[model samples]
Target: MPQTVKLRPYRLADEPAAVGLWQRSWQLAYPQIDFSQRLEWFREHWSGLQLDSRIVVAECETVPDHLAGFVAVSPRTGYLDQIVVAPEMQHRGIGKALIDAAKHLGREGLYLHVNKDNSRAIAFYRKSGFTIAGEDINRRSGAPVYMMTWRPAADLPPEP
Candidate 1:
């Protein structure tokens, strides 16, 4: 991990790095699925999705152009649309930083869906204070996913 990882609002120039980061992370997480086929779809919808949500990126101070990870969160409903960390950057607190940023933006709660088969992400979310809220099928991919949610109070210190 670098000495500093800065979180900042999404910028237009960050799109390419963001897309590449998402592609690599998703590919590694879902090896059975060929994300290349849907890369264009992600590109086309990237702008619109971030426009409607709070998108934050984690950048290492040493490597300015290298985007370690990012998270897309809806402030209104606290829906965590997406969070991806570069394969090389996993387990280094980038994802947690992104989640913390989402909490700051959406005090109501933070929620997201993870593929049922993604045990790694499930465990990570569990460690981050999220619980399985429910299950649902992803409309586009028709894959089963577990809806996970985390509330601000979940991590509050016990009343003394």
Candidate 2:
């Protein structure tokens, strides 16, 4: 049987692994960007954010020593700041579990911005029930991003 995966709050000890995951995932998803700049951005934005804002790490029962994935949520907006699974461990339900946990925390809905050119993420978010709410130019990356949102089950469908 497949091992169970546990989701728990992120600790300061997990920073290195989390940063490594962020670096690798970003490199795979946005290869054209300058590496140093991307790292700097992550260091500045992610590092400075309120840690208790809602960050969780996933670990498999069989190999509890390593983190398999992580999700970070903003307290105010309930927005998903980041959700990344190890490259070798994608599509094994890690992302879904993390998302479900976020929803369970009373996050009525969630939203995230994805680069317009990142078709893979766009597809994944769509499959996960997010719909494009609008598009806007991202000054930092010089790329257009699709602002996607998942409304509370009782809310009306987002107008296209």
Candidate 3:
């Protein structure tokens, strides 16, 4: 049977698992980042921030206890602050599911920044309909990043 994954709103209790997944994903993607600094950054950013930010977790039906991936979005600006999938579970549609869920929330557009050196993410986002809007140097890490956005396609009809 195919694995069933469900995306649900994030809760306070999910922080530990979410942070773990974030750390693991970051390490895998940017091995040069210092572990301590990365953890500290996550603590500050992911802590008791606005709950209105749509943070969703992806959990599998077979391994309900584990989170396969997660996506954090800002409703106001339609910015996808974070999207991470466990390295072992990637390329299996979890990331796409997360993005699809965010799009269904009626966002006018979606935006995110991917490290310029992270070609894997850049390609993935491009495949998912995101286009490079600009580039910037991350203030924290001084890394070059590509800002991407996904707007509603002109060919699609507007919602009633």
Q: List the pairs of residues colliding in candidate 3.
A: none
Better of 1 and 2 by lDDT: 1
- The total number of steric clashes, by the backbone 3 Å criterion, in model 3 comes to 0
User: Residues 1-160, candidate 3, lDDT per residue (tens digit)?
Assistant: 1267777788788888989988888887778766656787777788734454778889877886688888888887788888898898887889888877666553588988999989888998999899999999998879899999998776645432
Over 4 Å off in model 3, which ranges? 48-52, 154-160
Encode model 2's per-residue lDDT on 1-160: one tens digit a residue. 1257778888888887888888888887768765656676787777765454678888777786578888888767777878898887787888887777666543578888888998988998888788999999888767899999886686534422
- lDDT (0 to 1) per candidate: 0.85, 0.78, 0.81
Top-down TM-score ranking = 1, 3, 2
Clashing pairs for predicted structure model 1, backbone only: none
lDDT of 1 by residue, 1-160 (tens): 3467888888889999999888888887778889989899899878778778989888888888778898888888888988888888877888888777877777778889998988999998999889999999999899999999998985654322
What is candidate 3's local distance difference test score? 0.81
Q: How does residue 127 of candidate 1 score in lDDT?
A: 91
**Of candidates 3 and 1, the better by lDDT:** 1
